[model samples]
Target: MTLYETIFTRRSVRQYDQVQLEASVLAEIRQAIDNEKQLPGQNARFEIVNADRLKGVAAPHAILAYSAGTDAALANIGYTLQGVDLHLQNSGYGSLWMGMGKPIEQSADYRILLAFGKTSAPLRAGQGDFKRKSATEISNEDNAIARVARLAPSAVNFQPWKLDFSPGKVVVRPDGGGIRKLLTGNLQKIDLGIILKCVELALEREGKAVTALTPKGGGKTFAVEVAFE
Candidate 1:
């Protein structure tokens, strides 16, 4: 399946068949990580490690996703690794993002771990299988990009992004206020990264030239504006 197709059909898998991937497959996964695009100004790293090296998950293999620990690092980690998550599903493997899994002191640099292996959990049959917010709920206009962004996974499914679209650009910012803001502020950035990734993929599929993302005007929360070239 194509990566774009996997975007709609992939599901986060928890139970995995306890078999290690072949060396060639593992090498390909590592190479894919090496080629993943980076969000500007964010430094992220990834390494394949034994599942036992992580404290809270069971899988034949786990990837230690690490970053420079900058303010945008967590969100960037989400942006970077979401591609791998899609790729694994496209490759017929199952993957789950473990936000709470502890890396067994292999390094303090680890930010998140992804557990992946074989599994019998069925691939989601279609886009309809996704239980996500509607496009209207996440954006000003209910367009194709917004439809895809609405399906982006977030911490507890908070889906904390509000999008504004223009003729040649897209601007994304945080959504929610009051207690929800206080509770999900930091996590919302990571959620935005995931949404940004969805937008990028959707735009690319539409033959739009995605430019480098730049920061928007001043606000306590982070915002990004992406222009189509």
Candidate 2:
């Protein structure tokens, strides 16, 4: 399946077979990560490591994300790596976004990790298998983009963002009050980026040319605009 199709069937896979992937497979994974486009004006770095280099994670491999602490940087990591998350699962591997996992070696810019490896777990049957808020609750308009984009995962399953659709573009903004206090870390910003990838992929599948992924604002005002034609 393509990344967009994978979105409907993907899940946060926890159980793994614990076998390290072959060098060729890991190379392909790295190639995908290296080629993932970042949001304009943001630079995020990703590193692939083995199980021995990590703590608090069971997967045999991981991709460590490093970036500045700014809201745009965090969201760029989310938006970019989410494509890797989908690609891994779409290729029959398992993946999970790990907030608590860490690298044995520390770096000042380290932000988060995506744990992935071979697994026996099954992919979700489809969108029906997702336990998420209804379209009416998460989007201003009920449509295909909202349906696929709402499946984008968030920290603690908070789903703390909403979508507003307009001609040739869609704007995503924080959904409810008290999100910052409730989600102490900046994971919510990353969630915005992740969903932005979903929106972009859905648009591409519909034959729309995505002209830009514009991330703006900070604090309670954070938002992302996906422009297409």
lDDT by residue (31-127, candidate 2, tens digit) is 9999999989888989999999999999999999999998889889999999999999999999999887899999999999999999989999987
The regions of model 2 sitting more than 4 angstroms off are: 176-181
Candidate with best lDDT? 2
Model 1 ranges off by over 4 Å? 176-185, 216-219
Estimate the Cα RMSD of every predicted model relative to the unseen true structure.
2.0, 1.3
Query: Distance from true position, residue 11, model 2, in Å?
Result: 0.8
Pairs that clash in candidate 2: none
User: Residue 167 of model 1: what lDDT?
Assistant: 88
Pairs that clash in candidate 1: none
Q: Give the Cα-based TM-score of candidate 2 against the true structure.
A: 0.96
Clashes of each: 0, 0
